[model samples]
Target: MNPPDNPSANRWLVTACLAQVQAMRYTPAGLPALDMVLEHESQQHEGGGERLARASIKAVAFGPLAERLARQALGSCWNFRGFLAAGRGGKGLVFHIQDMQNT
Candidate 1:
């Protein structure tokens, strides 16, 4: 038996506080675009003990979602649903947010 290739597991979701929101911009295609950093902190059980997990990730949203996100205040918490992908110019990872809601 061979393992099947499955990329559907690339989905990512997290609840985090928004910070450093850039001014709304338009893409070459004229779609609204927004970029920002997300700060996440939570406690999780690890090694039978509680541990704090913290991270800061780069995130971007486009189109109507971007327009909506642009209106959100910094430091606001949101539940973000997205997928990870290599950032433009193939540098590091970027969270391409598909949808989000206030947390």
Candidate 2:
């Protein structure tokens, strides 16, 4: 399968998303304020194992407005980026931008 491109590949986009997400202060509302290249990081342990790893999570805002915006942004980069929730402990959401054209 081919990876998707990042909507927030541009610094401006990332900054905009980050700022908006933070300003919104609500996951549902904040989600739309960001570009599609945004991903939430989550940390967890494996079953019966003393190992730690990151996991990718497909996130969707719990509201119609947010979901619509998120979907719109994500759709643009769906072919170049993977929505992953950081498995490692972190303070906030991490946006990983990929160069789909290069890949």
Candidate 3:
């Protein structure tokens, strides 16, 4: 099956919240490398502090509005450490860049 086109075309693409992410297991999509950080907060909470979770996901910037999408993905204190390709030939997992900085 063909993967969905315009994955980043939506002005607001719905994604799993941090809490939801924490509850699930996500394999990184590619080799653990530092491409960029994509972060975002939970809309469930009206302008409140963003809940911590796997909000960031390693992605390629070959798409349109790559920078904006990455910025939107990494919402607040969220950080991007590197990338890791998913075992299933999908996408890589995103690491929290803040983890390194906080140390």
lDDT of each: 0.91, 0.34, 0.34
Per-residue error for 98 in candidate 2, Å, reads: 27
lDDT of 1 by residue, 1-103 (tens): 5534875677899999887788898889899999899999999999999999999999999999989888888899999999998998999999999989777
Q: Can you write out model 2's per-residue Cα lDDT over 9-92, one digit (the tens) per residue?
A: 333121122112222224543533323333323344678655544334322233343434443433232323323334227545
Worst 10 residues of 1 by lDDT: 1-10
TM-score of 2: 0.20
What is the full ranking by TM-score, best candidate first?
A: 1, 3, 2
Cα shift from native, residue 12, model 3 (Å): 5.4
Once all C-alphas are superposed, what RMSD does model 1 give against the true structure? 2.9
Among all candidates shown, the one with the greatest TM-score: 1
What's the count of clashing pairs in each model shown? Answer: 0, 11, 24
The C-alpha TM-scores of every prediction are: 0.89, 0.20, 0.25
Question: Could you tell me which 10 consecutive residues in candidate 3 have the lowest summed lDDT?
Answer: 17-26
Model 3 lDDT on a 0 to 1 scale: 0.34
